[model samples]
Target: MTVYQLPVEVTAFARWLTELAGRLRPDAGWYGVFAARDPEGLRACFDGAEILPWDVVESLLQDAGEPADGPLADRARALYAAAATAHDRRPGGAGALAERRDLMERERRYAESRARELGERLRAATGEAEAAGLENDLAWVRDDHARAAARVTELTTRLARVEGHARAEPVPAAQAEPAAAPARTQTPVRTPAPPAPARPARARPRGARYAWLEESAEERAPVAVPVLPTGGAAPRGARFGGGGDSAEAGGPARVAEAADPAEAARAAANAVYALQRLRAQGRSGEAHVLLCEALNGPPDRLPALAAELHRAGLGADWSTLLWEAASLPPGRLAAVAGVLADAGRAADCDQLLRQGVARPVEELAGACAALHAEAHHREAHALLTAFVRVRAPEDAARLAGADPRGLVPQLLDAARAVSATRERDLLHALRVAGLAGA
Candidate 1:
């Protein structure tokens, strides 16, 4: 059935129930009757009502294409009977208690089934890694099962208490009344209030930059440094020395000023590498600090740093870094796109390339050529076609010369799709110039 039809069916069933209850008992509203909390109150309502059996209710629900059995069916029957009883001003009695027991039983059975499935998976787990992953799932399932079992026990006890209460003999009306009390008076006593405890001194603010200094001695201890395995190249930002920007120029000065520059740089590289490994291992909190440090280090180097993070499987941070470095230089953007494409992020690479097309035609052509060389022909083709379509005819004529894969035929096809115009004439001219079908 379609999604829209299901709600209509449910509404129809509810309306039918309301009308049926009104016909049976006109004084009480359906909701007022069903909303009774106590078994005695509900039983009072059901006293003279002719309630339908569970099977009848189930068949009715099935006819309406709704679930006909289990907790849902029990609850539906309980509500219908309660509404009728409330209208008739009769007791609901044992009906409410019976529905509660059925609901709890169904819940317990579902929980047990879930626990069994999880236990089977846990038993079949092959190694420490697999077992560790399933540990939380198994624990949750077992806990739910235990709670369901405990609830079932509690419900059973309550059901017995309710049954016993129902079977008990009624007290005599005269005996149920309380005896008259004698009048008396007494003076009130005064008491003192307790004093509040004094507040302690406030500590200094510990910012993220110096958070390491606040760590305990054991946490601050030196550890073995990890090197990137053979075939895993360090990201561009990990390089120690560089030229061009002010950050690169000051790198040497910063290193020279440090007592142990080599060690410091090595530590930084190690930290970056470690963060990458931690992210791969799903230790996000530990990696977050290092990610912040890398991001806040140098604006010029952020893109390359982000590219490395992306390669290292820190996708969430990589996306943040990309947004931060959105206005990067054309060359840097192209480089970042290459890194993303190499890391199997073709969509990101294509997006970055589209942004790079806003640069000069020569730069755009070079980027397109690189994209083609990297076997991203589809992206390259789309980028060039969009560039031509948006540019003026004269501008497009100049840009078309740089089209490595002759897109002139595609342009002609586009031209034919539109009404004849100057743009179409320009495309025809370009086609005759051997650039269209090349």
Candidate 2:
């Protein structure tokens, strides 16, 4: 059933349980009661009223839905303990006398309504097995409630200390005496503090100059040095070898090459290539670590590193890296979409796609097919019109192959001669290969 088809009573009950859970523990709000997946199980969770894994709660609800009989069944019992703990901590009123009265009347009525709902659901379970499962779930909910009680007690004690401190503080006599003073004098206007001096701009560091070189796509800058005559001149592409000692004083002379920004970027990109090679050797985790280090090194080199990663088919990881880059701005979300699209994660790509992305229509058409191949037909249909509007007839037909009926007839109608026949046969082959599952 669709998510909206969930019973109204279930939604209302879940909302109350979620609110109660939130009040008891602030962090619990991150998980909603609907995540539990079972209406009766949620009621049991509310009844027990403590912190519990959302998944376990869902399992209990599943058990409750069928013939309940398992270790997972006693949710109602567990929920009872949680509810008792929550009920104890909730304020009755301003004073103990009022609190007692309110708890007895108002709180009791609310609890009775919620409990009545629970009872009706419990009575509806058909078989002995289902009842047994429900019983087990209730028991687990109780256990969770017991564990949460100690934590709640500690929090209540701390809150009491804070409240006591607030109450014990005495009001200054000067404030009380001011009631008789003139209206203008009641608020003593103090002179405003002078604004602090603006900080001097920081001088750019020397290393920052090298940073541009690391990221630049520019050609090499010329360097002047004395050239030695090695049998008239050195041969083209000849290697020059030297040890570390050669560069020191009184040692062998060192050859100095001109600085090249493009070469440096290429070298840095090559380092990413080395990491990718590691991935090809079944060391993906290590390659990811290395990519992270390279990307983190400097702002300028990051694009080069990202490009290399994309080329290596580490597009998914690269998207995550781009997301984590502090130096990068939010405009990079398009780049993220591109990477996700390339990785065939169309649903994920959809979250980051924005207006004005530089990506063309054909790319999106391909993405539609990828999503369709993944059995996400709804998403594919959403992009189909856009694909036809932008791409060539053949490209659009290929994307439309992902349609429920397949694209053979459409391809045949659009094409001529051998091309149409080839496409028709390809469609049949795709069907035979079971790529289109029944």
Candidate 3:
């Protein structure tokens, strides 16, 4: 039929499709073309609506009324008979049908296989992120973007090479000159050899006293605290091994040898510092692994040491590991919330915040705002509300009055809500407490 002769409904469908094409994905485009109202679109259609085979039509009828069971089980018996006859007439008809069935089965199997492969890769990547100290959820997203960009670059290069090869004109037999060259008279047309393989990169060597983080903490490094002699005398080092001259000499220490407690503590502290450096560099997973290695066993003051590690940016890893280790008790919620907030795992951070704020009442308003901007509003609200109630009650009250929607507004409102006298008193009390303790 001529273009103008088409029905109005068909014309509208065509225009709707033309507009939709810009937004529709490639996988879904085929179906769109199948239902197009234009002449060109109609020509390109699958034409399978009335071509349902006998078995499919019968199945369709048998499964009718359950639309999701699919059209295969909903067609009439007469439609099946027509399909059966048409299907039987095609070249190698029965064989082709069998082949098609096999192909579909194989495709499904391959799809399942690919899904399993992806799952494995995701799990491994997650482990690597944990190991490498990527405790923050945002870090995972950043890494994912980086990896995807690299893949795109690699694919683009490969495509360029393929296109170059495809467009190159071939030399015809009449123009070819290879056979014309004389074996003895001519220097051999030598082809350049492929480049040699690059040598494997070497790993960094570990020192004898490498400070390790706890596996449970997933910390990048051990916390190191410096200690000076309480006696106010500059001793070269402390004596171990029954506090005798033999211990102070630092010679071949015997089985009964014991390290100076202060020296050991210093070593642990230094290890923690190194771990802090790694965490700053976005290698928290490696830092955590290293920290565990350094400690070698349960240290006496782990929680305090962990707090120090958290200060070093290994907190996110520490919190994640701790929660996993202790059956995720309520007490650890506050710590986990803090770490997750830093790592920018806003969604997970929100969940942890909900669990944490009930007891400790430490609200992560900043975290809530961040996640909210990222479209995790439900979580952000939960976190921000809880945070205001616990850490900044005045601010929370102000927020409650203003009903601020965003991060800064929420923060400001919360601040304004607090009474000036109360704020001054709280600050003074904290300062005095620090002074008295010191």
How would you encode candidate 3's per-residue C-alpha lDDT over 365-402 as one tens digit per residue?
22332244344455555555444434434434332322
Q: Give me candidate 1's TM-score against the actual structure.
A: 0.26
Best by TM-score: 1
List candidate 1 segments past 4 Å from native: 1-335, 385-394, 403-438
What is the RMSD, in Å, between candidate 2 and the native fold over all Cα? 24.8
Candidate 3 similarity to native, TM-score = 0.19
Residue-pair clashes per candidate, as listed? 16, 32, 28
Full ranking by TM-score: 1, 2, 3
lDDT by residue for model 1 over 279-341, one digit each (tens)? Answer: 455344345445544422322233344455566565555643443222233223334455455
Measured against the true structure, the TM-scores of the candidates, in listed sequence, are 0.26, 0.20, 0.19
- For TM-score, candidate 2 versus 3, the one ahead is 2
lDDT of 2 by residue, 43-143 (tens): 55454332343334443345335223221222222232233323333453124323333333343344344445545666898989887776666554544
Task: Decide which is better by lDDT, 2 or 3.
Answer: 2
Instruction: Tell me the whole-model lDDT of each prediction, alpha carbons only.
Output: 0.43, 0.38, 0.36
RMSD of each: 26.5, 24.8, 30.6
TM match of model 2 to true structure: 0.20
